[model samples]
Target: MRPKQVFVANHTSMIDFIILEQMTAFAAIMQKHPGWVGLLQTTILESLGCIWFNRTEVKDRVDASRKFREHAHGDDNNPLLIFSEGTCVNNEYIVMFKKSAFEIDVSVCPVAIKYNKIFVDAFWNSRKQSFTMHLLQLMTSWAVVCDVWYLEPQTIKPDETSIEFAERLMISHRAGLKMVPWDGYLKHSRATIL
Candidate 1:
């Protein structure tokens, strides 16, 4: 048990977190530790069975934090893994963040996601790189890997937005590794929530 909360990556692939959704309310979550859990909702109308928040409470702020805390401090079956960078971007840089993930005063476990060059470049910003073609490529090809670094946990202060938190984590990236948009992950996900 690392902690009640885990800070994960804002992967360029929205699919990464979307893949997580099948595993938990927070699309990036794999398990819930058997207690209360708070997860951000990128795609709405999901009965994810945890605290459902919409791009910083677009889902319902009152319940999101309350529920997350309840699960975090309670006899949780698993810790919470949140993507502080709320939305996916296609730029070569981690974009702005929302603070909800950092609001919970706990330790942050920084996780980085690496991708194949084709996949990395596929994180689309224009019509040509939409999910339709992207998935076809992933289905046909094997993904390249980047070193996902799990750094020592940091004590989170409850005053940062997801974007701010993402920037802080970017400090772990390889030197000169440009940031691409979050869309790269989305292609692997069922849908982009928010």
Candidate 2:
């Protein structure tokens, strides 16, 4: 049998997961969203075998990790989709990828998504506005344009740690979009404190 595939992407907006979902029939690890989105997550997404967790809860994260590792190693036919940055960032930059996706022994396919802001900003700042607001803004805008590149598949080297593997994949992702590298979680934390 062929090695299992894990698709990883640099997340810029809420739609990043949805866009990737259209390309392949793969299950994803996602944050448990709120409102109508949460309803969909608990129903539609859950039906697809997607794993959901609350990012702020330590137990939820731990549980998700265990479930993710099991899913990756399982005999399921669908590949896994992961937004390794763990949170959304503006399109101008890419944040440090979480290493969990790389921890698995599977082929990693790095996908880069770049958005054109000529019409409207696609970044969904959930702290400032809700997903409903984001969608309304998009609906009123001229259009949302983006470019997605499917880079060559990567594998963790025999001697590499998961952190190193994640960094390497981040580099490949950065190559296509020319995004500034930043730790998204750090930015989020700082915003929370301020």
Return the TM-score for each candidate structure.
Answer: 0.59, 0.87
**Top of the candidates by lDDT:** 2
Kindly list the per-residue Cα lDDT of model 2 for residues 1-194, writing each as its tens digit: 24477788888888777677777777899888788889988878777789999988999999999988888877864677888888887787776788888887888888888888899888998889977889999889988887788877999999999877877775444534554456677765644454
Clash count for each candidate, listed in order shown: 38, 0
Q: Give candidate 1 misplaced runs (Cα > 4 Å).
A: 18-51, 54-59, 118-126, 157-194
Summarize candidate 1's per-residue lDDT along 94-172 as a digit string, tens digits.
6444555566666666665554565345354434675556766666766534445556676644776655655666533
Model 2 / residue 149 / CA error / Å: 0.7
- All models, RMSD in angstroms: 8.8, 2.8
Which ten contiguous residues of candidate 2 have the minimum total lDDT? Answer: 171-180
